[model samples]
Target: MILDALFFLVMAGLNLFFWAIIIAAVLSLLTGFGILDTRNRVVWTIGDFFYRVTEPALRPVRDRLPNLGGIDLSPLVVLLLIQAAMLLVAAIQGYLIRGGVYF
Candidate 1:
């Protein structure tokens, strides 16, 4: 039962991170296109919030990947990593369940 709960919590966390990455990506584009103004304190605050939440996860990916001029693929890679983590957790849970281990 504890393992199951832990798995669920992990999945939830990964989902949240996945959504955060997506939101940050869109916001970045909007800001770059001038659709979203970062000059306003409110806008800046909001943008900073997203950046703080995502940068830690994204920084390593960004550094390792080649710079593609104005294009950034780190978020896509992060999303893929998030999905992979969720799948790996689910697979472990499945294996434990099949083995008749404690839930």
Candidate 2:
């Protein structure tokens, strides 16, 4: 039971982080298109918040990725990684169930 609860919690956390990344990516697009005014404090604050949240996870990927003339693929890569992690969690849960560990 405890293991199941912990797994649920971790899955929930991962799902939330996954959404955060999506939100950050969307916000980036809005900023890039100039539809959002970053000079405004509200816009700046929101943009900065997303940046701080995502940059840590994305920085290493960004560093490893070769520059492609202002195109950034790190967010897409991170999203793919997040999807893989979610799949991994589901696989582990299935494995435990298959092994007859009824947690």
Candidate 3:
């Protein structure tokens, strides 16, 4: 029971992070399009917040990927990785529930 709850918690956290990456990407787009006024304090604050939250995860991926001139694919890669992690968690939970023993 506890293991199931723990797995759920981890999955939820990963799910939240996945959405954060998407939101960060959308916010960047809006700002780039001049739809979001980053000059405004509120907009800047929100943008900064998302940037601080998502950038750490994105930085390494960005470093490894070749530059694509005004195009960023790190967020998409991170989202896919998050999905894979969630799938791995689910698989572990299923294995435990099926009486698989740890070696």
For residues 76-95, what per-residue lDDT tens digits would candidate 3 score against the true structure?
Answer: 99999999999999888778
User: What tens digits encode model 2's per-residue C-alpha lDDT throughout 1-103?
Assistant: 9889988998998888888888889999999999998999999998899889889999999999999988989999998998899999999999999999865
Residue ranges of candidate 3 with Cα displaced over 4 Å: 100-103
The digit string of per-residue lDDT tens for model 1 on 36-92 reads: 999999989989999999999999999999989998999999999989999999898
- TM-score of each model, in listed order: 0.94, 0.91, 0.94
Per-model C-alpha lDDT, please? 0.92, 0.91, 0.92
lDDT of 3: 0.92
* Weakest 10 consecutive residues of candidate 1 by summed lDDT: 94-103
